[model samples]
Target: MKITLIIPTYNAGSLWPNVLDAIKQQTIYPDKLIVIDSGSKDETVPLASDLKNISIFNIDSKDFNHGGTRNLAVAKTLDADVIIFLTQDAILADSDAIKNLVYYFSDPLIAAVCGRQLPHKDAN
Candidate 1:
């Protein structure tokens, strides 16, 4: 099954590096990675370009909305069998996260699945 992982960002400078790293470490790598940046003024574009298996899109609009960027990213990959939406600030707890996500599709009836999110200790 082909899966597309979409990550939407806005001025996500240093945070994107970790997200891409986490994707690389996944036991089951996605078929494609789509990153949509909503007019970032930082180094996010260059950093995204350096990552393997990633397709980056830089939207020029001055108004930034996470949901809109996410929709655009999803539209770019409508052909994929499964879509995985991830935030740039998230880091998978395990390399098997993607593998586990894919396992749900084996049942055939399962249409979608979601992962859990936890606050970083440093956020406190």
Candidate 2:
């Protein structure tokens, strides 16, 4: 099944690179990766652009609404069989995270799935 992954970013901070790296290292990468970024003064847009196969769409910071931004991203991925949404700061815990999650879709009745989150290893 074709999978599309969308991440909404706004000044994602220093951890952005790590988040992208973790995604790139996934055992099963998304067929399409899209980043919807509101006006960010930082390097969020540049960093996302440097990655191949990532499509970036910009919106005014004032127009950014959590739900609306996500809906916008979804609009661009109509052809995908599965769409996965992740926040800019979310770091996948392991290479198999996406692979494991997609495996659940094999069940015909599973319409949606949510993954668990754990604190970072160094969280205080």
Candidate 3:
């Protein structure tokens, strides 16, 4: 199955690199990664650009809309069997995270899957 992963990013802050690194280490890497960046003044665009099989689309920060960006990604990955949307700050817990998630699709009746999130150790 063809899998596409999309992320909407702005500045993404200090944890952005870690998030991208985790994605790179995934056991089941996405066939295509679409990064929609809203005019960031920081290193977001440059860092994402260096990755292979990634398509970066730039937009003015003021024009960003949560639903619209995802719709655009859906259109761009029309041929993909699965499309995964992820926040720029989300880091996968393990290399098999995507593999485990995609495994559910073996059951043809499964329409969607949601990943569980855990609080950071520093969170109150």
Candidate 4:
């Protein structure tokens, strides 16, 4: 099954690298990776520039509508069997994170699946 990952980011300077590393280690990497950035004035764009299967789209920071931005990414990867929504701050719990989420879809009854998110240690 094909899976696409969509991330909405803003000023994700320090955090985006970790997010990219985690994506690289996923048990099953997404067939497509789309990052809709609201004009981050940092290295967020450059850091993601050379990654495989990744496409970065830019928009005015003020134009970001949480739902609309994600919808735009979804519309771009229509052939994907699943579209994963994530924020820049989210780090996968383990390599199986994406693998497990997609595994659930093997059951035809499950139309879509969302994974659990735990607070970052810094949030403590």
Give per-residue CA lDDT, model 3, range 1-124, as digits (tens).
9999999999987878988998989989999999999998899888888776899988888889999988977888899988888888888889998998899988999999989987655644
lDDT string for model 4 (1-124, tens) is 8899999988886767988888888989999999999998898888887678998999898889999988987888999998899899898989889998999898999997879889987764
For TM-score, the strongest prediction is 4
Candidate 3 Cα errors over 4 Å, as ranges: 121-124
Regarding lDDT, does 1 or 3 come out ahead?
3
Q: After superposition, how far is residue 81 of candidate 1 from its true place, in Å?
A: 0.6
- Specify the highest-lDDT model's number: 2
Against the reference, the lDDT scores of all candidates come to 0.82, 0.90, 0.88, 0.88
TM-score of 2: 0.94
- Count residue pairs with overlapping backbones in model 3: 0
TM-score, cand. 1: 0.88
Shift in Å, residue 87, candidate 1? 0.9
Residue 19 of model 1 has an lDDT of 74
lDDT of 2 by residue, 1-124 (tens): 9889999999998889998999989989898899999998899999888775789999999999999999999999899888889888889989998998899999999999988987766754
What local lDDT score does residue 94 receive in model 3, on the 0 to 100 scale?
93
Clashes of each: 0, 0, 0, 0
TM-score of each: 0.88, 0.94, 0.94, 0.95
